[model samples]
Target: MAAAKIKKGDRVIVLSGKDKGRTGDVIQSLPKDGKVVVDGINVHARHTKPSQGDPQGGIKRSPAPMPVSKVAHVTADGKATRVRFEIRDGKKVRIAVKTGEVING
Candidate 1:
């Protein structure tokens, strides 16, 4: 397994699709699927019928998992940047390829 380039809580920009150019924080990471769910991104609507558990069942909108390749890490300048691993002070850290800065985990 390889290190995760994108992880939960990281801000990212969508690279393609209807939500392209939009930025959001990573809500969940699915390494097995190579996908990530970003808050307010790739929202999908699901219509549901009323069930006994709930009095009213209506349309639900939620962020859907998108391929990790569709998103890139956002730099402090708000530009999308690729992530790279580097060892500094004997600790492996993620580096922003654009600005050569350390990314906060």
Candidate 2:
């Protein structure tokens, strides 16, 4: 699998879709699928029947994964930019293409 530019805990901005222009922290990244689950973005309500855990049936809102192509990494200055990988001090790192800040901590 190829390395993903986005990672958990990184702040990102949604580029397209109904959630476009929204920014949130990346909760998870699915590199194989090229999808990402950002906090408070792309939420969907799921209806569920009563199960073993809960007796009452209700609707639950959950975060759905969005395509990685639709999200851009948000830099410290609040601009959305592409990310690139580079080696610094003998360690591989991800950095913002615009600001050149180390993104992967």
Q: Pick the candidate with the highest lDDT.
A: 1
Each candidate: how many clashes? 0, 0
lDDT of 1 by residue, 81-100 (tens): 99999999999999999899
* Residue 6's lDDT in candidate 1: 99
Would you list the C-alpha lDDT of every candidate in the order shown? 0.97, 0.92
Residue 76 accuracy (lDDT) in model 1: 86
Q: How many backbone clashes does candidate 1 have?
A: 0
- Per-residue lDDT of 32 in model 1: 89
Worst 10 residues of 2 by lDDT: 96-105
lDDT of 2 by residue, 36-104 (tens): 999899999999999989789799898999999999999888889999999999999998999878886
